[model samples]
Target chain A: MPIIINLDVMMAKRKMSLNELSEKVGITLSNLSILKTGKAKAIRFSTLESICEVLDCQPGDLLEFHNKE
Target chain B: MKTQTILNIMFFLAWFVFIALLIKAGTILTTFSISWFNDMAAEKMYFDLDLSMYKSYSPIHYSLIVINKVILITAQAYVALLMTELLKGFNLKNPFNHLTVRLMEKICFSILVIWVMSIIHNAHLKALEKSVGLSAEYLDGSYLLWSALVYVLAQVFKRGVEIQTENQYTI
Candidate 1:
């Protein structure tokens, strides 16, 4: 439950908006929003790779884990 | 509209017609058997009408008639639900083709069973010295079959969503 989605951080670091990332990745805005807002129960490795490739960031930069106490 | 969308629309229209028919049938049956409708007693009530006394006369019964109407109404609801889901295929992002196919097969089988059971019930009533009013055997069978089919389809749909998620990962 504590799986961290660092999408917002990555977008800000890259000086990119959600619309720009969606357009560049060829994915719908709704899906990218789901990823960014951490509403997605799971994320696909392929999608993560695409995001990393587009943003020029490592996977660790886009995801993290937090202990649920 | 696509072929499936057109079919879905037709099915929805037919569902509406069936619902109207159900209401009409209930009203007609009640009008003709007013005494039966007014009686709240659980005991079987029989009336002897002399509409055609020249020919032999028998008492009009109410208990079985009311039961039949109730069953028919329930059957109509089941059919409406089935049609609604079929129509939903047009709007669903990833319709579960396999589940829909299986549901279609079940519906066909259920209809066949209903038809056969109704014929037998009608024949049985005719042999028992009573005019066959509508019987709910067919409707009851159809409702049960469709309810089961819907339950199974829901499970299949859940699995399909999971599969879609997995495919996204592999891509």
Candidate 2:
């Protein structure tokens, strides 16, 4: 629950809309929404690779850990 | 709206329609029986009763009636359960693979049960000097066969999910 998907922040930094990212990454807009909303339980490496390649970022830039306390 | 929520709404609507149809059928059957019974009673009063034919046909008629009701209720319950599982996806982890497998298992079990019940039902109808429509017989077999196919597909999906999860560990 403490894991964070920083897709929204990365998209903002890259000046990209969700539709643009979805088209670039070859993932559906709905799936990207799931990742952006932190609703996905897990992400495939292939999907991560696509996102990283398209956004010019490392996987670490898209994922983060936070302590509940 | 989420797919699950939409499915839940649709399921509830389907139940409402099923209940209405049941009530309508019950009313029609009751009226028919009452009229037929009165006519039979009048004939019995006026003449010496030869009750053998009536006694034989009555049980068969009753059995057919019972079978029809069972089939309707069983099918409705199956659809309702399937829709509920579909609707739960929005909140589930690994919704597509996880929920689909669960749904497929339920569907398989339901189809098997329905198929057996339907065979008994068709037999009852035949006993009553009635024939089931070709479509009805086809539906009975198709539902079960399709369920089996889906169950196999769900296993493949489950394996894919497991492989994906394992590969994540190596990375």
Instruction: Give me the candidate number with maximum lDDT.
Output: 2
DockQ score for model 2: 0.05
Off by over 4 Å in 1: A14-30, A41-46, B1-13, B16-24, B34-61, B67-71, B74-78, B81-143, B158-171
Model 2 Cα lDDT, one tens digit per residue, B1-171: 576667668767756665655564454345435535554532232124222243344645543544464465556565555755555553434544666667767767776676766666666545444442222221244656766786787788678667755543332
User: For model 2, which pairs clash?
Assistant: B4-B87
Error of 1 at B131 (Å): 20
Candidate 1 docking quality: incorrect, acceptable, medium or high: incorrect
- Give Cα distance to truth, residue B41, candidate 1, Å: 21
lDDT of 1 by residue, B23-75 (tens): 65565455446543443322222232222211113233333434444454445
How much is the lDDT of residue B65 in candidate 2? 48
Best by DockQ: 1
What's the i-RMS for candidate 1 in angstroms? Answer: 4.6
